[model samples]
Target: MAGGGIDTRVSHRAASYEYKVTRYLIFSCIVGAVGGALFGYDLGVSGGVTSMDDFLVKFFPLVYERKHSHLKETDYCKYDNQILTLFTSSLYFAALVITFAASHLTRKKGRKASIIVGALSFLVGAIINASAQNIAMLIIGRILLGAGIGFGNQAVPLYLSEMSPAKIRGAVNQLFQFTTCAGILVANLINYFTDKVHPHGWRISLGLAALPAILMLIGGIVCPETPNSLVEQGKLEEARRVLKRVRGTDNVEAEFQDLIDASKEAQAVKDPFRNLLKRKYRPQFVIGALCIPAFQQLTGNNSILFYAPVIFQTLGFGSSSSLISSLVSSSALIVGTLVSMALVDRFGRRGFFIEAGSEMIVYMVAVAAVLAKYFGHGEELSIPIAAILVAAIFLFVFAYGRSWGPLGWLVPSELFPLEIRSSAQSVVVCVNMIFTALVAQLFLASLCHLKYGIFLLFACLIVIMCTVVYFFLPETKRVPIEEIYLLFENHWFWKNYVGQRHQDTLAEPEKLGESKPAHA
Candidate 1:
């Protein structure tokens, strides 16, 4: 009877342990999603804020008067383009600075702590922006807001990647992007209703971002620090405890030892930055630093996202119709991103880029062609032409959201080695911000001058991007984080042909030999 009781207690305890680990994993993902939501809200709200009638009247009176005053819309287009650019680009400028700071903070203070700091900065920025009475104050708020975004964006994915099991890492890491789309959708929905709020509607839209920021702060406070980060800090015992809870088993000793080995290998590099200059690391540095950011921004998604309402208005929709159309476009983004989250792990990252890149090139050309034909006819576009323009825009956004939008972040997060991961990612994020700022700064002016030519230019850039993906980008699906270096070292053709097979062989117990047990 006593033996039976002991067996029953053991089974019950095993079930409870499994439940606790699952609960912790879910909660951690939710926390990371909160950070992502903040990023999306910021991106989504700006378009509405800039488009709001009251906001224009209060802050951008000159541009607002192009329609209401004696000047023609085309005549007044030259005015306030620079200032308007400043307003939108300022956040990214601040983000660039914070991306550097985030690297040190993530390394020194731990990922959770950095995220908390970001949340606090974001909350403060939201309050400032909400209460701003002048353009300067608003820009200040945006700067603070950018700082928060920088920290959270860098830390959250790193945290998630460190904690997730290898089999589910892609799906889990994708939660960051998924939540980003959700936040954007939420922001647009809020703006759609608040559009009628008259004097303070834009304020409401910008201010509401505070809610998710606060939630991120609370969540960051409560969640366990990632075991890898703890190992980096030499908190081995604490790391073990975290791994036990997060992994749901006492079998974490092997994983913990792997972390120790990786950390030691990382620490052995005397000067990490200089080491990147070596031949071995240069390719990844170039890919992470230059190619990824170029692909992300040169595609022109930021321009579309930041000026969706304006783009629709340019396509001959009224103010309300433009806002509504932007909402629909954002919805497509959400849906496409959801599909990406489902397939990114299964189909492989490089394949999506190839497929989506081709689609994007096609859609961009179609958009350019339609706009050229319509504008060539006159300022007044027929209903049929306008419908075609909108369709092209939606399809273009759908392809982009599924492909580059999420993978832009995911690929870089997985590509670099552990030693240089934070620093390299920061550099990538900084470059991404710089490109984003450049596009935002130039978008309105380019739209005014280039017209359909701008779309064609982006299409040309996409052709280049697709070529780069085919020749350069490696297939990183389900590749273990520690072995990512091997992917980079192989010739591009080898990675294309035998990379998965190589990874499969490496994953085999006999092939991996001693390390196999650790991974298992």
Candidate 2:
């Protein structure tokens, strides 16, 4: 089952070479990871600004008046306008579309090009948003911001993964996630104070988006291209030089040779996008390109992130206090990310996923139970109950931070071959964006209709996602990017299809039927 007349070249790259933490590697990764702030600032900023009374009154007066209605059924339904939700969801719609172009840019022009473009676009969008007086301008600005995110999301994870040695790849790549959380925290802190300033506070929150864009713009200029990318462009001497520098050694022949061979394999495939559709890649396509990113959004952590201030407002806090409440939750996200960075390499990816998934389920249920018991059609929630609700959600956010929030990006970046990496990353971002857009578009409406049951819906999604990860995703810790093929090739269910359609290799297949059992 391991082969159907297809050659298999298993790599011992990870075992053959070891890497030390080098200054260049750290600098490049930090620069690349700054891309996450562009994404995180928007996530944290949009929700807070939307919940600002002045912002809603100016841009969405219908929802604004409803917020003051004080009607029995208005608690969850106050901000449920479709057009209002568009302010948040519109960014993703634009991101999903632009990511295809970013894919080509990433593969042909290099990852840094896309990151630079993203930062530039975001900087402009921030300027427009800060000055906008109409809803049209705000939406247009969001669309531009989405374009920035599309490019950033497409390039940053792959950049981090390619630049890193296998031993510390998780921590390196997760710098993107950590920076994203950091951006969110900063945005929340800004909003907490800005909300108190009235009419122009939201503008200050919106304009500061330019700061992270500036950071990444500087970073894009500073960071070196990944050795894999250099090799892909046929800059073999440059690739060798970069590889030597990044690895901190002249003894990089083994890795350099592997990169040459992989580049040869990559060149033979005329169109990677078309090649990605081959049967041999089914496992990667289904789980990595499709399921993981989509499911990450479906876990609904962003619902809390995007509407945390709003949810707290409904629980009886003013805009400032609600922003403060979200600040606490965002702080937990940073803590969880740090915990993951410390433990992920040691504990492995799948363990963190399974453990965190279970933890999220428990917290989701706890949140739902509390809301259902004390929050009702005409009832006001007590201080104790609201505190408990926020506490449960804080733990939920922490669980998500460790597992899905970062792993969604990390796992997909791990799944693809270099030849199709850009294409696959594009798909990952598109699917993630589509789901994210849907969630952003629907969450307010769903919250109004489903009430506490909305929490239970996310819990059910967590169950399905955890099951898929258990059955389909293999542990990828410490696996070299060049060698990830073996993980799929030897996987219990994936082995059946991994190499059956690959056309570029001509070695004897591994002994058949030697794959691990399903539960292994």
TM-score of each: 0.88, 0.90
Candidate 1 residue spans exceeding 4 A from truth: 1-21, 67-80, 376-380, 492-520
Candidate 2 segments exceeding 4 Å error = 1-23, 478-492, 495-520
Residue pairs with clashing backbones, model 1: none
After best superposition, candidate 2 residue 199: deviation in angstroms? 1.2
Q: What's the distance in Å from true for residue 386, model 2?
A: 0.6
Q: How well does model 2 score by local distance difference test?
A: 0.83
Q: Residue 272, candidate 1: how far off, in angstroms?
A: 1.7
lDDT tens string, model 1, 1-520?
1100112232233334321346778878888789889999898888777877788888888777653433334621422367767777888889888897898899888999889999999999999999989999899999999999989988998888888865567788888888888887788788887888989998999999999999999999999999989999999999989888887787765567767766786777666677556555666777767788768998998788888877776566677887888888888888889888888877877778889989999998998887766664335567788788888888988998899998888778776776666567777888899998888888888877787788999999999988877777667776655565556545444333324334432344333222221112
lDDT of 2 by residue, 125-207 (tens): 99999999999999999999999998888888778878888666666777889989998998999998898887899899999
lDDT score of residue 389 within candidate 1: 80
